[model samples]
Target: WTEHADKKGRVFYWNPASRHSSWQHPLTPSHKALVAAYRRIMQEEDRLAAIQSELEAFQQQVEEEVKGWRQSHAPDGTPYFYKIGTQNTRWDNPRDELMAHMDLRMKMLQELSQMPSLLEEVAPPADVTGLDRTQDSAGLSEAAALTDGPGSPVAP
Candidate 1:
């Protein structure tokens, strides 16, 4: 087999015995099917890589957010604890509000933990070339908008 390049710089492989160019050579059905499958595989692999990268970025963001929340709420690094006892052991002012906030934060972390499995369950679309695969600050902007708005849990 010999490889030849046309005037347009397109290269193709063909048998030396053939008089016609590689392009003029007839491709068998199986050869066409193999080429189509190869293209599909390449496209799918690219899509999967993009999705994996996005998922990793999202995972890192969740971890950082949870870490920041924990640091801000508990600078001492002590885990929140609740104790049930008689009136003598119970303080007059219970930290129910702080506990509620901590509960919400815990729930958020729990939801974040499920992200990896969710990512695994996601499949690449048939046509990934047209999809926006960029990882940008749009998600952060949306999150900030939600948190910095009026009646938000956190103060500006």
Candidate 2:
């Protein structure tokens, strides 16, 4: 393998038969399958992390909204001021809807945290052991088929 960089950018060259090539080739079928599984796990991890972060932000929103409401309302929980002509209430109502949404999101975060450990269900259980980790066997088998050598579908 060889690498050359010009004013444009960097580049790499490789010969299939060369030992200790400069560039490694793409994954084989079995390797690809393993990679896919690993990707799935990583994607789930990212999603769960995002959810947790969002939940934290939403909590902050809830706090700010509640604080504003408390500040506008009187000590007795009544409106401290109203518009001169119109019956404009002063105190802001508690954000029941946002609170509810936050609650639901918290539940979703819990489920997402548990997702990686949970396995996929395929068939009826004999002893009810729960979801089977062996459910991804077909994908693994498909990837293993790539070992058939060059010109095979898995070769590239």
Candidate 3:
């Protein structure tokens, strides 16, 4: 297998059998690296999924808070309030109660963006090679068994 650099400066594995020089093609070294990377990515993906659930819960709470605020305030209030300017700005309307909600939404989005990196803290350190060790099907299953139920037979 030969490695080739693309116009965009991305390194890809090339094989004579397949016409494609990209990483997606069937190249042994690239495939191994991709598989390892994929395993590591799974943890991050699970974290993102949990973050989605958390975001949804927060959204529900925000909705409830907004609902309560609306009921207690002006009867003719807009749900979304915006500033009308590129740089200089003011509340779209003086009576808009949603400015706080918008602020909360922005905060939530920012936190959500950081969630991935935060979740990765538990991941193996960058200097630690073989974070997700390369294992064949049997080896993976064998290793996975160690974390299984109490009844699982431990290999002697």
Candidate 4:
């Protein structure tokens, strides 16, 4: 293989006795430019592949976390749905509803957990005194009321 440079200072390789005649022939400025562009495209592809691998790793980590959470919080032994319209069993335990509530809480907590990192990326908010940062438990009470309300299977 012989290396050659075009008028534009672009480089190419000349391979003799190759099935591809283009490689054996002298490269023009356009051909050199195409080669450079191809090299750049290959470099970009490599960089993207690295980024894709990182993303896959991160995805696997998240999946594992979710699996572990499900195993710990939502065991298979626990029934997720309750049967209705049965005299032998008038009502089922509110475990499924409670699990849904727990799942929602987990998702909210995950979102809230990212707030510190997001805040770090931007300017800090102005400090204000006497402002309440704590969440009210009224919503929790409301949810409980709903669970024990009429039409609820758990309701006596």
The TM-score leader among the candidates is: 2
Candidate ordering by lDDT (highest first)? 2, 3, 1, 4
Which parts of model 3 are misplaced by more than 4 Å? 1-45, 70-123, 126-156
lDDT of 1 by residue, 1-156 (tens): 356887998877665332334554333432453344334434553544544444454455445434333211235664433233322221212233234333444444345445564335556566423322334576432232223333444444
Cα misplacement distance, residue 56 of candidate 4 (Å): 28
| lDDT comparison, 2 vs 4, better candidate | 2
Deviation in angstroms for 140 in model 4? 49
lDDT of 3 by residue, 60-103 (tens): 65565445421122336623332333232222332332344444
True lDDT of residue 49, candidate 3: 62
* Model 3 quality (TM-score): 0.27
Taking all chains together, the TM-score of candidate 4 against the true structure is 0.20
Q: Write the per-residue lDDT of candidate 2 for residues 1-156, one digit (tens) a residue.
A: 245444666454443322223332322332453344344545553655555665576578667655543324667875443333445444333354346555655565556557754433335546333222333645542223333434344434
What clash pairs does model 2 have?
Answer: 29-143, 30-143
Q: In model 2, which runs have C-alpha deviations exceeding 4 angstroms?
A: 1-45, 71-93, 117-156
Each prediction's whole-model lDDT (CA) = 0.41, 0.47, 0.46, 0.40
Error of 4 at 123 (Å): 5.2
TM-score of every model? Answer: 0.20, 0.32, 0.27, 0.20
Give the backbone clash total of model 4.
Answer: 0
Task: Write one digit per residue (lDDT tens) for candidate 4, span 1-156.
Answer: 367786887766654423122433342533453344334433453434433443344445445433432211235464332234322221233343234434443443345334544223345674333232444566432232223333443533
lDDT of 3: 0.46
Question: What global local distance difference test value does model 4 have?
Answer: 0.40
